[model samples]
Target: MAQQVRGVVARRKGEPVSIETVVVPDPGPGEAVVRVQACGVCHTDLHYREGGINDDFPFLLGHEAAGIVEEVGEGVEDVAPGDFVILNWRAVCGRCRACLRGRPWYCFDTHNARQKMTLTDGTELTPALGIGAFAEKTLVAAGQCTKVNPAVAPQVAGLLGCGVMAGLGAALNTADVRRGDSVAVIGVGGVGGAAVMGARLAAAATVVAVDVDDRKLAQAEKLGATHTVNSRTTDAVRAIRDLTGGFGADVVIEAVGRPETYEQAFYARDLAGTVVLVGVPTPEMELKLPLLDVFGRGGALKSSWYGDCLPSRDFPVLIDLHLQGRLDLGAFVSETIGLGDVEEAFATMRRGDVLRSVVLF
Candidate 1:
């Protein structure tokens, strides 16, 4: 039987999201039904509400979630009912070129529930990032569920479902941050702060955080940032270079998703140092740089998609680390909110007052 559950939905462009009755069908082939326990309020959710992601009206507006698998469709052997899992947007198809090449993180083909979740009037809703989860229950591809240690709280583990994963992956995977390396992360919000934490986990000698807000910089310090630069009043590039013994950082991660921050990351890295772009930018945003400087930089300039993470491999390990107190996942959760507080959470997020305001079911 189909279930009708309350979910946050953006019914039209540039409008506020509301709690609406969402109809979720039972899992079809290769699909699963997840009972969402907690979902994080990400900037991307607000983007969907503002029609920035697409014209897919009535978007189901949450993705960073952790839940229990309530049911699985035929041929689904990976996850069974009652398993704790973190929901991932990317469900790699093994036959895709990227997957066949053993780079499933770059999988060109990802899967989602083939059946649509609709409204009371039968209007189809687009699930944000293919894993709409700001509801009591959601339907997704079986591969979207990555099992993690159940010992961790759902709200903390759910962060790995999106932003936090992206930040950590940017440092660990994209930039290949290593012990003794010096790293600088621009825009120390949820994602950037996670990058700082990732560098610390990698044993980086220095983890410098740059942000416009002093509060976020302080938050980054708690997350293992060795130094903080308030870009609002400081020359970030110079500060980073001076901190790194006038050589700049070995790896600079840009998490602001703006041309200015990207340029800062580029100039703040040592010659031949890697620059990782993890920030999400709008389509209208364009980057321009000197061709000579590009050649002279002599290092990789990479974009981190979902933190270049393989969810199955990364989620479980991260959960274990969190369980052992090696990773401070709890630091990311600024507050726990009820489902109805999602709209207010957006305002709080925009004000840069909190790292994350997670909605608990």
Candidate 2:
């Protein structure tokens, strides 16, 4: 039987999202239905509402989510009904070139539910990140569900589904930050803040956070940033170098995704140091840099996609760490809000007042 649930939906571009009746069908082959417990309000969700992601009108927003599996399709063995799980956007297909090469994190073909959820009028709704989860229940590929320890709160565990995972993966996996290394993260928002925590988890000796807002910088400090630089008042590149004993940081993570910030990250690293670009840039944005500098910079320049994470592998470990008090996932949850408060949450996110405003179901 199909179920009718209230979900946050963006019916048109540059318009406010509303709680609409979403009709979700039962799990089909290779799919599962999850009862969403909580979903985090990410900048990406707002981007979709503004038509920044695509022209897929009537988008079912919200992706950073944790839930309980209520139903599973035939042949689904990984997760069963009643299992607590974190929903991941990337569901790697083993035959993809990236996956075949044993790099499933870079899998070119990820999976989603074959069937579409719809509005009451039968209009097909595109799920944000292919996993529209702001609803009370969402259907996804069985592979999209990653089982984690159920003891952790849904609000905290759900974050591993997106931004937090991206930031942590940027530093720990993409940059391979090491003990005693000097690391600098630009932006200091949810993603950047998570990078700061990732650097701490990696045992980096010095972690520098660069941002325009003092409040975010203060939050970064709470997340384990050894130094903070307000780029609006100080030259970020020079300040990072000064903090790293004049050689520059060993790794610079660009979380702002702007050309100017990219350039700062390019020059703010030590010789042979890595620069990780985890920030999402707009389609119209172009990056122009000196050819000589590109050639002269001896280290790897990389972009982190979803922090290059394998959800099945990373999610449980992160959740366990969070439960054990090793990782402060709770700090990321600035507030818990009801589904109707999504529009207001977007405003709070834009104001940079909170790391995350989660929609608690």
Candidate 3:
């Protein structure tokens, strides 16, 4: 039977989200229903609410989530009820060209449940990133649930579902930071700080964090940044270059996504170094760089989408690492609140007041 559950919904752009009774269809073919325990309030959720993502109105918000699988639809053999899992947006389609070419991480046709959850009035709700999770129970494709170690706290484990994974993946997977390499991360927010942690885990020798907020820089230091630059007053490119032996960092991760910050990252790297862009920019934003600089740089410039993550492979390993105390996933959870406080959490996030104000169902 289809289940009705309490969920956070944004009925229009730039308006506050509200808790509403949403109708979630029972598991269809290849679908699963997860009883959400914890879901992080990510910037993407705010973007959707603000109409930055698109005109997808009445969005069911929240994506970075972890919970228990309560039921699975027919042909769902990989996971079963009672399994603790992290919900992921990317359920790779094996038939996609990227997957067919053995690069499933780049699979273009990642999917979610074919069925849609709706409001009581029959208005369809577009699940945020295909995994709307700010609810007691949510419906998703079976492939969206990545089983992980059950011992990890749901509050911490859910982070691996999105931003944290994206940051770590940007450094280790996309940027390929080498042991003893110098890395500079621009924008020390949730994603940037995670990039710092990833660089530290990857054995980067000098990790310089750049941000406008001192508090965020302090947080980044705890995450493993060896140096910090408050870009608001200082010239960021010069400061990063100065901190990195006057050449520039071997790799620069641009987590801010703005045109100016992108330029700062472009010039803040050593010759032939890498620049990984994980921050999202709006459609009106355009990046213009010196054509000669691109040719002269002589290295890869890449954008990391969800950190190029294959949830199945990455989630379990990350959860185990968190369990073993190697990664401090717990620190990312600045506070946990009920679903009702999502709008306020968005404000806190915008003011740079918290690392993550997770919504606990």
Model 2 agreement with the true structure over 1-361: per-residue lDDT tens digits: 9999999999999999999999999999999999999999999999999989999899999999999999999889999999999999999998989899998999999989999999999999999999999999999999999999999999999999999999999999999999999999999999999999999999999999999999999999999999999999999999999999999999999999999999999999999999999999998889999898888878989999899999999999999998889999999999999999999999999998899999999
RMSD of 3: 0.8
**Tens digits of per-residue lDDT for model 1, 285-324:** 9999999999988988999988999999999999999999
Off by over 4 Å in 1: none
Query: lDDT for each of the candidates?
Result: 0.96, 0.96, 0.94
- Sorted on lDDT, best first, the list reads 2, 1, 3
Please give the distance, in angstroms, between residue 68's alpha carbon in candidate 2 and its true position after superposition: 0.3
lDDT of 2 at 197: 100
- Per-candidate TM equals 0.99, 0.99, 0.99
Q: Write down the lDDT that model 1 would get.
A: 0.96
Instruction: Specify the poorest-scoring 10-residue window by lDDT in model 2.
Output: 291-300
Clashing residue pairs in candidate 1, if any?
A: none
Number of backbone-clashing residue pairs for each candidate, in the order shown: 0, 0, 0
